[model samples]
Target: MTQLSSNQFIRNLTIQDIDDCIILESKGFPPEQRCSPENCRYRLSVASNICLGLFETTPLGDSKLIGHILATKIATERITEAGMGKRIQGVENSGHFENSRNIGIHSVVIDPEYRGVHLGHIFLTKYIEYIRQLKLADKILIINKESLIPFYSKVGFENLGLTDCRFAGLIDYDMVYNL
Candidate 1:
């Protein structure tokens, strides 16, 4: 697979990315597994600093958001439906917990054309490094399908076993990468 060109790079996402994010999100997740438009905006408004996006610069100098990892700060070790849902305790409608110790990764999406190019792996590694540098959270958590456990494991995430959190009737494994 071809790699991203030199002009492409990863940066924190902005509210302006919501449209691209929504489009890419639909392509990446199942209906029930997808974050709704409201929640996407909430995550960005509350924690845009952790919403990492991989963008490719076009020949005209405009940037296209191709991939993103949307995360939220929470106190829970294991992810809950509420955590992944639009709102959760301590996450006020207007703001998020400033001292949340754990970072819950809600989504990881790449444009359909960008798949199979190792962009997910590269993006994830860079995310971990970026989070670690900030020292904002003690751990980074994610709930993923069994098929992806190995992929996440490759990025130093340890599978803590099956979780009670069910979405789209698929079994999910709770994984974590300690910073």
Candidate 2:
């Protein structure tokens, strides 16, 4: 695999990226924490643009996806609604992706080999900029590992305390970044 560099570019994900994304997701997260393939496909099919990918150019003029951030938009009110609220546990099942004012950041993963280079920060910064440019949502929320609270804080996300939803059966915190 080609090493990622500063020349890396961020772009909207495409259908062709699903498989690679699933592979990376598997590698980056534990089985229970992994989003199902069906859900991954659903996100790509419905909200491809908001699903962002980080790619680096290869020596042979190809590009390889090294990281990705998947998110969906949902209304604040619907977040507390019955079935719709439960779907917030993961973006794939969220019924409000078609039209909503809040952006739920479902998952973010980087190639294990590329972990220490700050790619997560770079990807999130660009994603936030993109969201701001579109003005699609007033806030962005994420359920993440408690250990990562500091990491997300650096990106302007404020911790809202532990979430009721247990993704992968792990204790997770809900954090939000107001746009």
Candidate 3:
């Protein structure tokens, strides 16, 4: 794990992390909203370096993944020209991960037991830092619930109003953070 503190750290997701990530995904979102295991595996195979997990170190030298944020890179032009509405589909379906200038945050989840501790914020901050360090993308985008607009805004994402694509029967808003 990439140490963030004495007891906490963030690191890239690995093949071994898929099961844990799926569990967290199930707990965090409904079935229709969660990415399938195949998709998660595909993401890891393609861009494992960008898929991050936040963990707390145990006294016994073990660690638990308490939160995670996964992303896929997409061409900035596609988003700017085609618009986010047209590309809200699955990243694996888009075939845009190869060479891109923007990152789409597919999911972000924190363990229920770990909420309210700003762990989500901490994970996101560190994720952004990692992105910058790697020069990964020119910007980051996310389609999130309206309730999360302010939260994302606080993280430097600008609201782009409602999105055209609907997933899991919930209305979502598009937000972007330019690097």
Candidate with maximal lDDT: 1
As for candidate 3, its clashing pairs are: none
Better candidate by lDDT, 1 or 3? 1
Model 3: residues with Cα > 4 Å off, grouped in runs:
1-5, 76-93
Q: How many residue pairs clash per model? A: 0, 0, 0
Supply the global lDDT for candidate 3.
0.77
Model 3: number of backbone collisions: 0
Give the per-residue lDDT digits (tens) of candidate 2, residues 1-179: 23336668889998789999999899899887776787778677777878899988888989888999876666552222221233456555444456677877777999998788788887898789898998877888888888899999998999998877665567788888889
Candidate 2: give its CA RMSD in angstroms: 4.4
Q: What tens digits encode model 1's per-residue C-alpha lDDT throughout 1-179?
A: 33457999988988988988998889888788887899899889889999999999989999988899998886577787667656545663323455888898989988888888888988899899899998878999999998999899998999999988786677989999999
Those runs of model 2 whose alpha carbons end farther than 4 Å from true positions after fitting are: 1-6, 77-93
Which consecutive 10 residues in model 3 have the weakest lDDT in total? 77-86
lDDT of 2 at 116: 85
lDDT of each: 0.85, 0.77, 0.77
Best by TM-score: 1
RMSD of each: 2.7, 4.4, 4.4
By descending TM-score, how would the candidates be arranged?
1, 2, 3
